[model samples]
Target: MFILLFSAVLAESLVEIVNSDPTSSWVAIDYPREVITLAKMRAMLGDETEVDGLETMEYVEPDGVPTSFDARQQWPGKLFAVRNQQSCGSCWAHATSEAVGDRFAIKGCSKGVLSVQDLVSCDKNDNGCNGGSGPRAMSYAQSRGITTETCLPYVSGNGRVPSCPSKCKNNSTITRYKTQNNPTFTVANVQQELMNNGPLYFRFTVYSDFMNYKSGVYQHKSGKQEGGHAVLLVGWGVENGVKYWLCQNSWGPSWGERGFFKILRGNNHCDSEKGFWAGSVKC
Candidate 1:
């Protein structure tokens, strides 16, 4: 019993386990920490039930979808930079906004960064900071539209989502942009959509070990289940004989690899390879 207790404690020390494990596909390092409880982690993912209704758009598989693909490489100078969601469990908002923003940029729209705060505050369908799903946020983005990040900058990192504003913070004649033609791509054709469009939005079960991800491809070597968290699916490739999905997180650039991570791919680790949603910007 004593040995089991000690082993559990050791496993909880992310830095220790990650650094010592020879077989760990990923790496970990210590950083200034936040006391993220299980409840908060659960809130990070929000309600994803709305995603069940997504209609899978048919796509004729194109010849030669690359074995490896990265949106950043494909569309240089267009994709928005990584952003921080702060203390708010607004990954849902960030992922949807960022994915839409990327589509906008890929389509040669004038703006790149969209207002995550716009969805966090104004989208009545979602639960603000407490939690929301990618599809619901996409739905909100489609119907009502969202403004640029410059117009209504994100200030809800402190966990308090401000009231929906009637006008932009900069008051520069807000031009709202909407996403059109919601398309759902399954594992069979996900890469094709990403190659044709921009980033895709999806949610996956995040484990406690995920918080300690520093670099390399991650595969849940240890730790307990945290909760579902939404993120932007950016790319995928194989590293050291292991396949991984390169995803961007909203926790900011300080976390993971410049606010991005790679998880076990193809096998649907944490359901990462499930159907994902993306759309073109109605600029």
Candidate 2:
């Protein structure tokens, strides 16, 4: 009990110090005070995967790439609603589903939400709620495909992944939405991928200070290493001379800027530029 209280108090003090910095590009909040232990916070973020020499999609820089771009604004209602993984380390599943769903929408396919639960329970290549890789999830989506949220639905919030179901909740036949190829995009062509495809899945190292992020361009300032997390990379922009990537997190709409946050771009802060995965949908 004493340890938990001490940790919470220490984190709160750190937030105060971060907010007090007048030159800080971001603001911190004490919203994640409920997560008393590092293990609990880590449970919300999946482990990061190594992507050295991993094959990335072939690319050529498209003309007229703008300095500022947002996938949510570019495709309006095509992006799925920001979701919450709760205490489950299923960020890999959530990010992959959002990216695939966004691509499906952009490709003039079904605009309905895809099932993260399908990936969580059925993707044998992944460990479900414990932790998974974004690239592995993408590969699973390409090979086996994923069903709609209406077919399987998500129930892993309590850190328990239910058994994979063979049929939809309503007993209707399952429709597996798939992507043509498991294409990995690099930081050099991330903007072009977003402009041509949609939101993409990427993992990053999460720090304790990042849990308190409220708004603005986030750059890790303090706190110990927590774990790795995956999020949907939506777009990019320059805020106050700092280039940042706009991302949508799965911690729900209450956290950050309506479930979206901007992080330092170009320099690969938090390893956010690594593990990029996006592909063309197969409807």
Candidate 3:
């Protein structure tokens, strides 16, 4: 008993092996051992608006079953995807594009992948490839609208912020998307909104252990605090008694649960559920 207790304590002090995925889609990287740079780990969401301090609507958990509802499953090809931002911290732009892109699909608008490259290059309020807030990206979409991937492909992978383009290459064919800002809310309010609104732009803190998360409902276990990250929250579900929010990431399909993750829900675990901007995609 004493030896077992000591071993448990020792394990807590170290990054545990988390790659016990049943489906085997997780690609694990023992983060601390791998040692990713501070710059590379710094994805956007650091500039998110304070939703917890806002005038929030009261949320009452309605009657429901503990089950899964996948946005990808619902919309099929229409739903936005889990992409890669390379080593750039343009997650804010990526999340914003996917979130509103989903809204376009939900409203029966033509299916399109909104361009993060446009936001990265054009949103004068943001830091381009360095970092930016998801909310600001939404507002940028609302004001001037954003072009598609074909019009302006992502060049942030080259690791330099270019000047904002005065004109999209395929200006006439470029389908732009627009959005209106909505207040941020908790997981209590997410269930219905996700069903009705498609996907949402959300942010959360990333810990060292997150790098090892391949599968399973993620919770902050043992690891160093990394920094803030922005992602798209598409839906919610329950798995093995744990309520989780299904999130789509921009780290490509090779990361997380096939570029998606089920995070522990309801208590705002890692601040992912704390505050997320809701919006209306102008169809």
lDDT of 2 by residue, 1-283 (tens): 8877887886787788789988789998877554324556678888556655554433333467898999889999899988988889999999999999888888888648999899999998899988889778988988988899988889998999888887899999888977899877787777888898899987788888888888999988888888889899999898998888899999888889999999988766777765588868765
Top candidate when judged by TM-score against the true structure? 2
In candidate 1, which residue pairs clash?
none
Q: Count the backbone clashes (under 3 Å) in each candidate.
A: 0, 0, 0
> For candidate 1, which ten residues in a row score worst on lDDT?
32-41
TM-score order of candidates, best first? 2, 1, 3
Residue 83 lDDT in model 3? Answer: 82
What is the Cα-based TM-score of model 2?
0.92
Candidate 2 weakest lDDT stretch, 10 residues:
53-62
Candidate ordering by lDDT (highest first): 2, 1, 3
Query: RMSD to native for every prediction?
Result: 4.3, 2.8, 6.4
Per-residue lDDT for 112-140 in model 1, tens only?
A: 58999999999998888888876678888
- Lowest-scoring 10 consecutive residues by lDDT in candidate 3? 30-39
Residue range 1-283, candidate 3, lDDT tens digits: 6754653444334333444434332334433322332344554334344445544344345556336777788888878667888767788888888888778877888547778888888899888776777667777878877778877888886567777776676555555666766555555666767776788888887876676576768877655676778888877777777777789888777666778887877676776656776578766
The true-versus-predicted C-alpha distance at residue 161 of model 3, in Å, is 1.4
Return the TM-score for candidate 1, rounded to 2 decimals: 0.87
